[model samples]
Target: MKNNLTKMMALDIYVSNLEEEKYSEITTELQPSSKKSVNLISWGIQDLFFEKELFNDLDTIKTFSKNFNWKDNVSTVIKENYYESLVLTDAEKKIIWVSNGFTKMTGYEKEFALNKTPRFLQGKETKETTKKRIQKKLQLGKPFKDVIINYRKDQSTYKCELHIIPLHNSSNSKITHFLALEKEAV
Candidate 1:
């Protein structure tokens, strides 16, 4: 148990350092500090991994991990380089959340994406078979993985690897939302 805790703490420290380095290089306007000091102790950093501070202050690290809008900090840095994007859509297929990675990948701003169906990301080159497969899976509330050509805001197309899962309500087990994760073709 002690060994495991040590390993976990080491991994947390490593990840915290990497995130800090990434955060420093990302857009300054969007950077979010982890949190105030009070929150860190209150949240019990020792319970997280270690009693020692990670890359940043204990409070900052705690806030960032537990309280802050991690999506914003991660979204900006991740999209500019990494190929990952997350999308959340209602059962009706209207967009609810489109990660910043999606914006960077497709050039469609969040404001433009809200309430919009992902079909807007398709263009002339998009495969009909892939679209139909995606549609069928969603209609059946099935998780799906596929590779398809997708269009960006500039009308340029890129090959995308897509994975989608259905989010279900706990009580009735009815599908409530869809989560899509897409990675750029490498």
Candidate 2:
């Protein structure tokens, strides 16, 4: 048991270092060649393995929220609804992060969803009125809950319940990001 624990600790440290390196690479501007190298490293097998293992862990999620300087309310919402698939977006509505459950629920990989708007999940069957309502709510910078038909990567439709919260920068009280806790509506 002690040996196993030691191995686990070592693996955790290695993964942590890799995550820091990836974050550094992402934040730093790089030449095209360096960017390609970073992409290769970012999408390597170990990244996939560790991200899958770590993302579902509640403690890891809490640490992630804190590390990214998310507001208390944002962290609370995330902690309370951790079981639900989470989609976090920049103020512009571009996806910045997603829980592993999001991929499981939508059949879309994290890489595919990153930097894209949640509208990618909508299809012809999605109501225009509902979309407009969601946009308006977002514009108002308020938390709201709504249900809409959303398509998966395979184009299958599902009724998705979205609890959307606009996060603010605690220092400035300005909108920083949006968090959506989502689940399939039965």
Candidate 3:
């Protein structure tokens, strides 16, 4: 048990160091220190493989895990020479992945929203046509992109033009995942 805890702590430290290094070389408009600290604790808790009690006691761990894609967003920003973006999941619909230029546009850190569903971006005024389009594509294992009104957590709406591609896992025709991208409309 002690050895396991030690290993968990070691791995957590390694991941935290990597994150710190990455943040240091990247964005300067904000400090990711708070997010990093939460992530470090989350990693340690997960490594320990404790019970639900411990897990929920540090609900931030779950929050951090869900937002794990911020790392990807940061890397993408660097690679594409953009500012920021968001990645989402359709966990209820079957693990669909989606992303938006959030950091580049909105100020929310990816760590604060790792496992969030893109529906969080939806608004009361958002057209059903757009939802239908997404459903059609999701059903047919096809990819599609369109412009629509999307809301942020702050109740502010913005026009988002986005696209998605279905990823198949097998030559036998098994769909494994969907990768979606959202870009702010001009």
Candidate 4:
């Protein structure tokens, strides 16, 4: 029927917009008929999407841990927190890898953040004292947690909590990288 065809078309459009991350445009353009279908699709798809993302994150963590010979430590950390984003930086504080969730949270794609320092996320509103504290913690070479204001690519500010752990090379027992489990403060 024409009604069925229209609903299917609307669902397709809605899905396309979701894939494009056009969240702001989705609500304004929604129709009553399409809304119901979208709701149903969202319920079904959201779980699968979450599972896939979780698996991907786990795999990334596994790979990094294996490379760094810190599987046991990383596994314990993973069990303790559900992170929204993961960032890996060299000992020098240059970003090396970021999870897809990092882009979702910060609006900065991995490519844009690669080879840059996490300091790029800081802005005028970010506290200098917080920066100093983070520096001190990093120098201590210990795992620590802190919250700070971070700016998105669009320049919007958000409270970000970082659980930072130092990655030490097993052979040399020297710090090689820092892994940050990041989440947006609710």
Residue clash pairs of candidate 3: 66-114, 66-115, 67-114, 84-103, 84-104, 85-102, 85-103, 86-100
Instruction: Give the candidates in order of lDDT, highest first.
Output: 4, 2, 1, 3
lDDT tens digits, residue span 1-186, model 4: 567755654564345325345765575665565445332557667667656777887788788878777623775676567678889998999998998999999999899999999999999999999999889989988777777899999999998878888888777778889989897765
In candidate 2, what are the lDDT values of residues 1-186, reduced to their tens digit? 567645644543333335456857754442234343223555577456544544465464466556656664554665555234788898899998888878989999999999999999999999999899889978988776777899999999998878888877656778878888887765
Output the better candidate (1/3) by TM-score: 1
lDDT of candidate 1 over 125-169, digit per residue (tens): 888997897788678775656667888888989878666667665
Q: In candidate 2, residue 128 scores what lDDT? A: 100
User: What are the lDDT figures for the candidates, one per model?
Assistant: 0.62, 0.74, 0.49, 0.80
In model 1, residue pairs whose N, Cα or C atoms come closer than 3 Å (at least 3 residues apart or on different chains), thus clashing, are 34-64
The total of clashing pairs for model 1 equals: 1
Total clashing residue pairs per candidate?
1, 0, 8, 0
- Model 4 alpha-carbon drift over 4 Å, by segment: 1-51
Task: Please give the distance, in angstroms, between residue 169's alpha carbon in candidate 3 and its true position after superposition.
Answer: 0.7
Model 3 lDDT per residue over 1-186, tens place: 567655654543334334457757654633445643322557666445333323332343234334543222222322332112334344245323223345434455555555665665677989999788777757876544556688766677777755554544334445444545565554
- The 10 consecutive residues of candidate 1 with the worst lDDT sum are 49-58
* C-alpha positional error of residue 138 in candidate 3 after TM-score superposition, expressed in Å: 1.5
Q: What's model 1's TM-score?
A: 0.56
Candidate closer to the true structure by lDDT (higher is better), 2 or 3: 2
